[model samples]
Target: MMDKNQSKRFIQFAAECQSSALYEHLSLHIAEDPELLELSSYAQKGQPMPNLIFGAVHYLLLNGKEHSLKNFYPSLVNQPETEGVFTYFKDFCLAHREEIIPILERKLVQTNEVRRCAYLYPSFCYIYDKVKKPLALIEIGTSSGLQLLWDQFSYSYGTGITYGNPRGRVHITSEIKGDSTPLLLDTAPPVSVRIGVDLHVNDVSNPEDKQWLQALIWPEHHERRELFARASQCVQETPIQLIEGDGVALLSQLSDQISTDSLICVFHTHVANQIPKEAKKRLTETIQEIGSTRDIVHLYNNMNDGDLHLDYVHNGKTYNHTIGATEGRGRWFEWNIVD
Candidate 1:
């Protein structure tokens, strides 16, 4: 087995592989494969990868497919055959490269989804600090309510294993970087408000939606499957205010209704990528206009748009945390400049 340093570098190598040869090869392979063609029937230029494969993969990976991904040998590359499981996953990617491209597209290639994925933990940390009491958070583009349950639980990072360690009943040592994390009303109590918005909100509890979520999972990645299952379960029991509407339009409307003292945090992840340039501009303008009057704070992800430099455009100081599936996944930053 590889040592910690080697494993860390391996992750870095994986990060670099994201947009280079691997990406190009997968794209070309998928374009020619019939399975990919069938899977991508509903995928337009802007739409996320079709629902069928995504849901199926999500279920398989999370519920029962950990062994396949964790213990398989990679088929593409021959070098660095450090362990049995890693090699199996590499083989899975290479052998079924064509069939699995769409699944990867949905998870990593989707720009909007990438943005939302990064925002998950940062937004959680931001709210925890800002709201002293239990929060009533409304998340935009919450594919499943995994992010919303971030504060409701805790996590333990171990060698080659990560599991669901609940917060109240179990004491898990986790460090959150922020001024303050919102204290729950009761150790066992749920947050005050939990809602999700998606153009097509995946009903995580529904068997069909679960299937689509499974398909969304990349082949042979079981850790994520575990995460998704826990998250899906959270959404199923929690009463979420999920609605089908344009996020920008809905947020504009929601802004008007939220009381000043209610701690309104308008958040969106991975959803902005679907928004047109004109729509994005309008949304920003709307937020700026709204911020002029009310005490509102937005904890959204930084877009790759050259025009909007959210990295340093803060009126106040900014705090940045380097985050992603791998190290240096750009900066996961937050700051309350409006205050």
Candidate 2:
């Protein structure tokens, strides 16, 4: 009855999601099983998004649902259209409500993608050229402080364009979309100071938090999954300090700690869109206040979309440009230079 009474908006969302990006297995299974609508009766607000669905799946997989994951999951079996998918899926959902309910209650869809450092390279290089010094960097909404270390990874975006740490643990490659390829930095400038600010921070060392981080990744994306493993390993060798607080509240204070000699850069990818209008306003004001005192570059983009843009202030002048676009997980990049 819970599945029968549960709202179908999530199912509809699943259908649309499959069309846009390639998360067909999770989306399709959910769409086909309207019985899952019964989950609404247990509603943490009467609905669950794909994130909640996958969260439950991951929790079970990481714990004790090996047979369910192995036999039924599309990512594992390679077939969402296979018969009995919705049947087994429904059984799992219904049977595991005890576990799924609390997960649905938490509503955590937070994902920290490390490969996006591939998208940030060109922007960092541009800022380095302007300031000609190492960067003092701070990140907002840094779930695990992973992407905060983008410069530490190597990238091969287009055929001839290669950059970043070649010896780096994680290697990211993206396709070129248009004629205007982005400027490549043979070597990324050094990042001397790095800090992360978030309402809740994930400790990479913690096993439960790490599994949750992995759960946020779409199932079919093994490359991204592997890359995340590498980056996490990289972090163990060099950890960035994470400041637990609201991003805007911490921005000014962190910016103050940066030395005048090194370039100051505040950046976030796929983090801004989740913020409400009022919070975004505060972030904008905080950046502007910092800009008034000195030059700083803000590298940013929204969730799901690959485009990376630059907003920076130099000598009291503000400028904006679309630096490039890449796969959501930074698989490839079509660097767009705005002249």
Candidate 3:
């Protein structure tokens, strides 16, 4: 992230996060226009607003400006023909500069989509075996706790490989990267407890928050958009408890609260990338310190690994295991099982 050209770096990073014509057009548009470049320059703040370019477009779409970019966005319209049509888009964005600045100023893209659960197969598989029965799951960056109810959503990895609630409205599918897939249980584990900690817990029930969550999704991914809608409904039907605070700071106290009988497992997906390196160091140290008194399992999937990592405290040693490799959107995973 420490680059001389901040604006160029932000645009490149934002382009990678997106997969549709709207974003493609936006990238080309921002790269050429000085006004757009200046607007995107605000993202130099780093972790606070990592992807400011996308945030600006997402805010506009969520705030009833979908008409501005609907023709370019594929998910909203068929084929989405926007050939050489960046002037109007630029004008629309330029007009909404004041509205976008506030969204761009917000801290990070707090996404809580359940589609991410597709990457948790290995983590959950390990927990199901080691924990035996009931699991006390504590997620670090659990945004709205949608992924907290992972077991509730069904999944289809391939024609033969499938799991979770088959009748469930939300369905996520990942392409198999390799032959070595984890031996996942046909059914999800029995959850005795589920709680998540976040700096700002998003309530799916709230209109603005729910809309924001929807906005965070890329415009091309229609399946994910549908899955999100389904998951949001589940949020209203059965609400989850998400504590607000710094997870690394609040983890120890939260871990101590888990009952002795239940197996304590701390986990996070694509979260550590948002925090400082020192904070990540503190989180690991805190987890290991807490392990001294009780048995605890920690799992994390981040950009560094491209797979889920398991840290189990056994015989006073933290045995680390490389579980599996998955796509950014959980499109596929090549599971590497030690056992």
Give the candidate number with the greatest TM-score. 3
TM-score of 1: 0.57
TM-score of model number 3: 0.90
lDDT of each: 0.45, 0.71, 0.72
Better of 1 and 2 by lDDT: 2
> By descending lDDT, how would the candidates be arranged?
3, 2, 1
- Model 3, position 232: C-alpha lDDT score: 83
Candidate 1 Cα errors over 4 Å, as ranges: 1-28, 31-42, 48-134, 156-191, 305-339
Error of 3 at 316 (Å): 5.4
Model 2 — which ten-residue stretch has the worst lDDT?
Answer: 1-10
| Predicted candidate 3 versus true structure: per-residue lDDT over 1-339, tens digit per residue | 333364466467556755665666566556656677677666536543335566567657656674546576665568777775577667767877888777776735777756668767546766668657577788898888888888887788777767877777777787656546566677777777888899888888898887777777777778778888888888777656689999889888888888877767788988888778889889889988988877778888663655778887744666777767666667766666656
* Each prediction's number of clashing residue pairs: 33, 7, 1
As a whole number from 0 to 100, the lDDT of residue 143 in candidate 1 is: 65
lDDT of 1 by residue, 152-224 (tens): 4543322232223344222222232333332222222225666666666767767856666655545433344
Q: Whose lDDT is greatest here? A: 3
Clashes counted in candidate 1 amount to 33
